[model samples]
Target: MPQFVRKNGFWGVRVNWVEHLNKKTVYRRKYKQGFKTKREASMWANKFLAKANSGELVEQKIPTFPDYFMQWARIYRFTHITEVTKNRYIVTASHLESYFGSKPLNKITRSNYQEFLNEYSKDHAPSSVNKTKGLIKSCLDSAVADGLIRVNFSLGSQATGNKKKKLVVIYPNVEQIENILNLALERRKPYYPSFYIIITAILTGMRLAEICGLTWDRIDVENRTFKIDRAYNHLATDKEHIFKTLKNESSYRTIRVSHNLISVLSELKVNGSNLVFAEKNNPYKVPYSNGVKHPLKKIIKDLDYNLGDFHFHSLRHCHVALLHHDGIDWYSISKRLGHENLTTTLKTYAYLVEEDKIKSDDLIETQLDNFLTIGEKIGETSKKHKIK
Candidate 1:
């Protein structure tokens, strides 16, 4: 219902409605003024009431950016995301708070959001900027659906960063890889688990988290295979070494192991712990990925290989390079690496694949040269017989 009133020289109308907020019913009212005639005011009130009755009106109470982001993330993202990923969201919320500072969600315009992104990107990497932009966009999109705002400010915003690009994927050459493996095998001691971890990484191409989370049950000595179904969450605050699901469905795979690797693993004495690479004293706990890097750096230093900025993850790339050198197809390599698809493998190792192509071209040319030589010899023999 509407109440008609006269104020000064114009007609006005007031409409009342009821809405549910926080599981409680609340009354709301809106007033329209400056109508020339009572009939005009009545028509406007009718349209407003119809919209309100149909639940098409936008929400009146809008939350700040940080408030809505935290709310949305807890409801939709917190359950499925890993501890590290949740930490990233928390950091994003912190940034929103620092930048927006109690600004209402609907008040954030496109230009305002873009300016924030541009400013944030000045110090962050492009990837980091893009991730933040994506997160904010997702949150604002939900806000739009909830009728908190009419548009997502982050929709058309560009992520620009002046941070230096990351270095190219650096993997050791074949000789360097062999030297590294030999050195690791020689220096391997019960106290040093990095050696074994490095060997496993080179052979299996498993991510560091996967290797840390690996249990004895996952390894099948008889079948010479290991299953990757879980990863260790080193970032988990609730537990020292929490096991979580793999990165994606593709990460849950079984990879074949060589006999030498099986021998090395079988020789490892498991001290009542199911973990293959448990901590020296605490069998229940696993070594952090960073802990594995110190000894690796020492090994690289000893080997005197000029591989720039090599780390444990470089072994995974080394494994891919080995596979490519052995003439394995991209699809097989993809499966071995447990990639989501072949495209990921190809994209990551496109340069190495191109190098392999050049080698293949040379091999083909050598075979053609041998064929030509054989044909020329046969032609000479036939001509000599005809002359005789």
Candidate 2:
């Protein structure tokens, strides 16, 4: 029971408890004054004692928003996430520091967070704003779990940003793709690995990181297939040419290659190096994906293809387009491209699918018309025979 007393013309309460510190028992007391009546003091003491007995009372100092966020990320996110993902968290921390400078995590209200996002969206793209918001929301969720904040202020917050239309997907046509492939094949040499990487990407529809991490052991020349299990971490800070697991389980797949592609890969393989796209002079190192862009641009210019913003990733899109042209289904294309689901392939190549649908509709109409015309001719011939 708490002891009640009257001091300085106000009622007060004193609560006592026993605590253990470093294997030593210690007695602790808490005092609260300025209550108007003994009943009020008694009520407050009961609540405080209940919290203390239940072990819910925490007396640690609260950290600022940015400080807590950085600490949370270091403990929970740094080791598990990629270098690029870590940079995004760091950037979000910087933004929090700029907006909430020295503000306690619990002191920031939902309105304050919404205002910050509103200001941030004025100059950033919608996608960028959304990413930042998502990162902060995750951090705030951890804060709530840690008993640092009562609520996640970012919940139900709306992110609005500069409205810029996304660019259309432009891939190379059949003639242009053939020209690019031929040029890459002619320029490919033992010392130049970009051309080889280009050819592999076009044939396999592999991401740049996957092609860079490809090894000779993963390829089966007899079966004409290669397995994708890992990828090169290009922008990693800890180590160069480090191999990392694929993005997801769907990304781990076996791709069948044509005989000609197998022949090309065989010719490029070196006796000592296991990597298929190793560096020029050093067989142990892999070339960066950016290294392929210059040569790819040159090829496009030489072929006079009018593709805008053409880059290394365009090869993957070109592969999809070629498969679509060959009358392959979306599910097959999705699997070939290592997509997580058929919906991803459909959404990404919706224009191509729409075009195919239009062509199919026209063919269906034409075939039906021909069949009805033939039926009418047969009916007229049968009527004439009956009259005779």
- Expressed as tens digits, the lDDT of each residue in 165-233 for candidate 1 is 534445688888888888888887756576888889988899998998888899888898998999987
Q: Residue 298 of model 1: what lDDT?
A: 90
lDDT of 2 at 134: 79
TM-score of 2: 0.81
Instruction: Determine the C-alpha RMSD for candidate 1 after optimal superposition of all C-alphas.
Output: 4.1
| Local distance difference test, each candidate | 0.85, 0.84
lDDT of 1 at 351: 85
Across residues 1-388, which tens digit of lDDT does each residue of candidate 2 receive? 7999998889999999776656777777999999999999999999999887765663557899999989989998897776768888888889889999999899999999999999998878887888888778898999899888888989999977876632344677777787888999999886778888899888788998899888889998889998899998776554444788787789999999898987877766663578787764666577675689998989988888888778898898878877777888888889988999999889888878889889999999999999999999999999989954
Given candidate 2, what's the lDDT at residue 342?
Answer: 91
